[model samples]
Each structure stands twice: as structure tokens, then as C-alpha cells.
Target: MSIEVNNESGYAVDEAEFAALARHVLDAMHVHPQTDLAIMLVGTDVMSELHVQWMDEPGPTDVLSFPMDELRPGRPGDVTPAGLLGDVVLCPEVAARQARDAGHSTAEELLLLTTHGILHLLGYDHAEPEEEKEMFALQRQLLLTFLATR
Candidate 1:
């Protein structure tokens, strides 16, 4: 997988960790080895613009996903085809505030957001109750398993 992380948020973050976490998630989901992904960390202003432009939301959100290939998770014996997975845009400022409310570090919140965004790229959504439950459960499971390796 080719995972690129671009930090334009002007905030100090572990870019390598983001790439590693993305790799872990993609590998666990059995995505093809040649798959490509991009993670962008941007400021509130840019995030706000993107939020309104893409999601039609009013303010800066924590993370946003723009999927390119619309790939789904693959089974143990079947890996996803090689393609551009998507771009996951993150706002550190928003994540920090949410982290304070959630009583965790900004890094942890970002990691969770990264996982959530990747799930969205993998065609998982939470617009409905059951979808939310399934998506959140898988998100928790993937995050916990990744954390265990640290």
C-alpha cells in the first residue's frame, strides 16, 4: 500500500504513526498491496470550507473521507483489488477539542478518526441505527486490536 500523509494543519503530529495505523487497517481488511491512500491534516479554516463544500455542514468537522475506488473489506482468502482507496482529511484543532471532552489525548482521537474515515472509504456508513451499530462495533474492534500492538 502507498499511504501518503500530508500535514498542513501547522500542528505537530506523528505522520509516521498515521501511515502505520493506516497500513495496519488496510492490511487487516485485506486490501491489495498496491492500494493507495492519502491522509491530509488541515487547519480549521480549510476544514470548514471542505465541510461545507463536501458534506454541506456548517463548521469544521473532525474528519472527512473522499473515496476514490469505493473498495470494500475483503475476506481472508480474497484481497481487495489494487486501486486508490481514498483521501482522509483531518482537522487537529477540532480533534483536540473533542479529545478534551472525551478525556483522551489528541493523538488517540485522531487515530480513532483515522480508523473511522478509513471505514467510510471502505463503504461503511452510519446513517441508520443498525448501520451505526455495525460500523461503530467494527471501528472499536479495529482500533482496540491496533492499540494492542503498541
Candidate 2:
């Protein structure tokens, strides 16, 4: 698997840890070894621009996922072909604020968001109540397990 992280947000963050987290998430999800993923950290201004351009939202959000090839997890007996998993853009400044509210470290918040983005890339969504429950539950489980083995 290819997991690349680029931090241009001007905020110092643990880029290696996120790369490891992405690897862990992809390993758990059983993504193909040839799969590729990009995690970019941008400032709030760029994130806001992306939010408006892609999502038509107002301001910068926590995280956004852009999927390529729409690669879903393969069935138990099927093999998943190699493909680009797309990019997950994040804003560390926004995450820090959310971290304060959630009473966790910034790294922890980023980990949660990273998992959330990976799920989205894997074709998981939370547009409905049931979907929200399922997506959030899986996100929580993945984060907990990943952190435990740290």
C-alpha cells in the first residue's frame, strides 16, 4: 500500500504517525497492497476553498474525502484490484478546535478523522440515522483498536 502525507498547514504535526495510522487502517480493511492513498494537511483557507468548490459548503470542515475509481471492499471470495484510494484533505487548525471541544489531544482527533476519511474512501457514508450509527460505530472500533496496539 502507498500512503503519502503532505503537511502544508504551517502547523507542526506528526506526519509519520498519520502515515502509520493510514497503513494500519488499510491493513485492517484489507485494501490491496498496491492501493494508493494521499493525506494532505492544508490551512483553513485552502480547506474552506475546497469545501466550497467540492461540497458547496460555507466554511472549512473537519475532513473531506475524494474517492478515485470508487473502489469498494471486495467480497470474501473476491480479489480487490489495485487502484488509487483517493485523497483525504484535513485542516489541523480546525481539528485543534474540535479536539478542545472533544477533550482529546489533537493527534487523537486527527486519528479519528483519518479513520473517518478512510471509511468514506471505502464507500461508507452517514447520510441517515442508521448509516450514521453504523459508520460511527465502525470508526470508533477501528480507532480504538489502532490506538490500543500503539
Candidate 3:
């Protein structure tokens, strides 16, 4: 698994552990070994800017996923070897707040966001009622299954 991670925040974040966890999550979802994923850990300032620029929101969010392509149901019978899954931008400050609210560690919160972002890259959307139910259900299921092994 080739994961290109960028920690833009000043906070001391765990790089190796998070990378391993991300790889584990993608592997659990049956992503290709060559699938390219990039993650950026940013501060609230950058997150706010991104939220406005990308999502047209005015505040920071815990996570944002920018998927390059609509994920199909399965790998094609004759598929190309190369794949770019796109990026997931995570804000540590927001994650910390959410962690406290959820009564979990910051790392755990980030893990949840990471998995959530991956699901988005896989064409999972929680916008509509049915979509929200299916997307969140799969997210919870994946998180539970992957975390149980660790």
C-alpha cells in the first residue's frame, strides 16, 4: 500500500500508526494494492479555508474527502493496474473536539474519519436518507470489523 501522508498541522501527530491504520482500513475494503491514497493533517485555519473553498462552508470540519472518480461496483474484468483514490484532509483540532464529544481518544476519532473518508472515495454518500443509512451503516461495520482485529 502506497500512502502519501502530509502532516501540515503543528500538533504532534502519530504518523506511522495512522498510516498503518489507513492501510488496514483500505485493505479491509478490498482496495487494490496499487491504489493511491493521500491524507493531509491540517490545522483549523487551513481546514476552514478548505471548507470554504471546496465545500463552500464557513467553518472547519473533522474530515473532507475529494474523490477523483466515481467508484464502480467492482474491478473490471480487464482493469488497469494503476489507480488513484484521491485525498482525505483531516483537521486534528476538529478531531480532538469530536473525540471529546464521542468519549474516545483523538487517534480513534481520526481513525473513524479516515475510514469515513475512504468510504466516500468508494462512492459512498450520506446525503439522502437511504444513502445516509447505507453509507453510515457500512462505515460503522467496517470500523467495527477492522478495529476488532487490532
Candidate 4:
């Protein structure tokens, strides 16, 4: 897989770690090895604009996903084909505040948000209660497993 991370949030972030987390999530989902992914960290103003434009929300959000190929998770034996997965946009400023409330480091919160965003790219959602349960469970599992390997 080809994962790229661009940090324009005006905050210092470990770009390599975001790439690694994305890779881990995609690999665990059996996505194609040649699939391309982009992770962008933007400022609150940019995020707020995107939120209103895309989601029609009013404020900045922690993360947003724009899927290019609309690829779904693949089984172990049937991996996804090579394609552009999508872009996972993150707001470090919002994540930092959420991190403080959640009692964790900004990096950890960003990692979780990154995982959540990638899952969205893979067609996972939490709009419904059942969907929320399943998605959150899988998100937690993926995040914990990835952290374990690190």
C-alpha cells in the first residue's frame, strides 16, 4: 500500500506514525497492497470549511474521509484490487482538545481518529445504533492491535 501523510495543521506531528497506522489498518482489512491513501492534517479553519461544505456541519470536526475508489474491506483470501483508497483529513487542534477531555495524548487521539477515518473509507459507518456498535468495536480492536505491534 502507498500511504502518504501531509501535516499542514501548523502542529508538529509524527507523519511517519500516521502512515504506519494507516498501513496497519488497511493491511488488517486486507486491502490491496498497491492501493494509495492520503492522510492530511489541516487547521481548524480548513476543517470547518470542509465540514460545512461536505457534511453541512457548523464547526470543525476531528476527522473527515473522502473516499476515492469506495473500496470495501476484503477477506483474507480475497484482497481488494489496487486503487486509490481515499483521503483521511484530520484536525490536530480539535483532536488536541478532545484528547485533553479524553485524558490521552494528542498523538493517541489522532491515531484513533485516523483509524476511524480509514474505516469510513472502507465503508464503515456509525449512523445507526447497530452500525455504531459494530464500527466502534472494530475500531477499538484495530487500534489496540496496531498499538500492540508498536
Candidate 5:
């Protein structure tokens, strides 16, 4: 898998570490070995614009996912899978602020956002309470497992 991370926000972040987190998220979801992902650590300005334009919210979000593949048309066993996932835009600045509020390091917060975004690429959604529970539980488990090995 190719996990490309671009730090375009001019923030002091460790690209290699974030890349590892991204890879771990993809692996946790059983994405194809050849799957490619591009991650951008953007500033609040960019994130705010995206939030307003795409989601109709007016604040910077920690992360946003844009999946390239469409949902399978039928039952899982009856349809072919599309191997291409899409891009994830992460705001490290927003993540850092959230981290401060959540009482964790920025790295930990980024890992959470990474897993959440990758899960979205894998057709996971958190629009409801049960869905949020399942998605967040998996994300937390995977992130904890990844951190445990490091």
C-alpha cells in the first residue's frame, strides 16, 4: 500500500509517523495491498472552506474523507469490489486543538482521525448512534493496537 502524506500546512508534524498511522488504518480495514492513498495535513483556512462547501458546516473539522469508489450495488457476495479508495484531508491544527480538549497528544488525535477517515473510505458511516458506536469502537481498537506495537 502507498500511504503518501503531505504536510502543506507549514505545521511541525511528523510525516513519517502520520503515514504509518494511515497505513495501519488501511490495513485494519483489509484494503488491497496495492491501494494508494494521499493524505494532506492542511490548515484551518482550507478545512473551514471545505467544511462549508462540502458539508455546509462553517468550522474546521479534524478530517474529511473523499472516496473514489462507489458502494456496491447489491449484496456483498453478488457484487465486485472496486479497489480504488480516495483521498483524506486532515487538519493537524484542528486535530491539535481537539487533542488539547480531549487531553491527548496531537499524534493520538491524528491517529483517531486517520482511522475514522479510512473507515469512511471503507463504507462506514456514523450518522446514527449505533453506527457511531461500531465505527468508533473499531477505530479506537485499531489505533490502540497500532500504538501498542510501537
Candidate 6:
């Protein structure tokens, strides 16, 4: 997979760990090895612009996903096609604040956001209560599995 993590946020985020997480998640999800993905870490200013432009929201959020080819996970035994998975934009500044609120480290907060972003890229959403449960459960499971190997 062509998973690339770019830390343009100017923070000293661990890029390699994120790349590895992406690889692990995509692989477990059965995404093709030729698939392309980009993870972008940006400051609050850039994230706020994206939030307004894409979501019409007021300020920077934790994460945002912009899917390219609209790739979806294939059924078991089915061959997943290869394509561009798209971008997951993250804000470490917001994550740090959320971390404080959650009583966790900034790194853990970012991992959760990144996992959430990946699920969104794979056509997951939490607009409804049921959807929220399923999406969040899957996100938590994926994160736990990824962390276990670290």
C-alpha cells in the first residue's frame, strides 16, 4: 500500500507509527496492497479552513476524511480492487485539548482520531445512534488490535 503520513502541522508527531497503523488497519480490512492513501497532520489554522470549506463548521475538529475512489471493503473471499483511498487530515492541536478532556495522552487521542478517520474513508459514519455504535465499536477494536502489536 502507498500509505504516506505527512506532518505539515509542524508538530513532532511520530510519522512512522502512523504509517504502520495505516498499513495494519488497511491490511486487516483487506484493502489491496496497491491502494493509495495519504495522512496529513496540520495545525489548527489549516484544519479550521478545511472544516469550513468541507463541512461548513465553525472551527478546527479533530479529524476529517476526504475519500478519493470511494473504496469499500469487499466481502470475504471476494477480491478487493485497488484504488486511491484518499486523505485523512488531522489536527494535533485539537487532539491535545481533547486528550486533556479525555484524561489521556495526546498520542492516544490522535490514534483514536486516525482510526476514526480511516473508518470514515471506508464509508463508515456515525449519523445515527446505531451507526455510531457500530462505527465506534469497530474503531475501538481496530485500535486495540493495532496497539497490541506495537
Task: Give the poorly placed runs of model 4, Cα more than 4 Å off.
Answer: none
Tens-place lDDT per residue, model 6, 1-150, is: 898999999888888999999988888788888999999999999999999999999899999999999998766566369999999999999999999999999999999999899989999999999999999999999999999999
Clashing pairs in 4: 1-33
Q: Can you rank all candidates by lDDT, best first?
A: 1, 4, 6, 2, 3, 5
lDDT of 1 at 101: 100
RMSD in order of candidates: 0.6, 1.2, 2.4, 0.7, 3.3, 0.9
* Candidate that beats the other on lDDT, 1 or 5, i.e. the better one: 1
Scored by CA lDDT, what does every candidate get? 0.96, 0.91, 0.82, 0.96, 0.80, 0.92
lDDT score at residue 57, model 1, on the 0-100 scale: 91
Judged by lDDT, which candidate is best?
1
Q: Write the per-residue lDDT of candidate 4 for residues 1-150, one digit (tens) a residue.
A: 789999998999989989988989999999999999999999999999999999999999999999999999999989998999999999999999999999999999999999999999999999999999999999999999999999
Which pairs, if any, clash in model 2? none
lDDT of 5 by residue, 50-109 (tens): 999999999999999988874322242343343567788999899899999999998888
TM-score of each: 0.98, 0.95, 0.88, 0.98, 0.88, 0.97
Candidate 4 lDDT at 72 equals: 94
Tens digit per residue, CA lDDT, model 1, 42-77 = 999999999999989999999999999999999898
Q: Looking at candidate 1, what is the lDDT of residue 121? A: 99
Error of 3 at 103 (Å): 1.4
Error of 3 at 105 (Å): 1.3
Candidate 2 residue lDDT tens string, 4-73? 9999999898888899889887877777878999999999999999999999998999999999978887
Point out the higher-scoring one by TM-score: 4 or 5: 4
Worst 10 residues of 3 by lDDT: 72-81
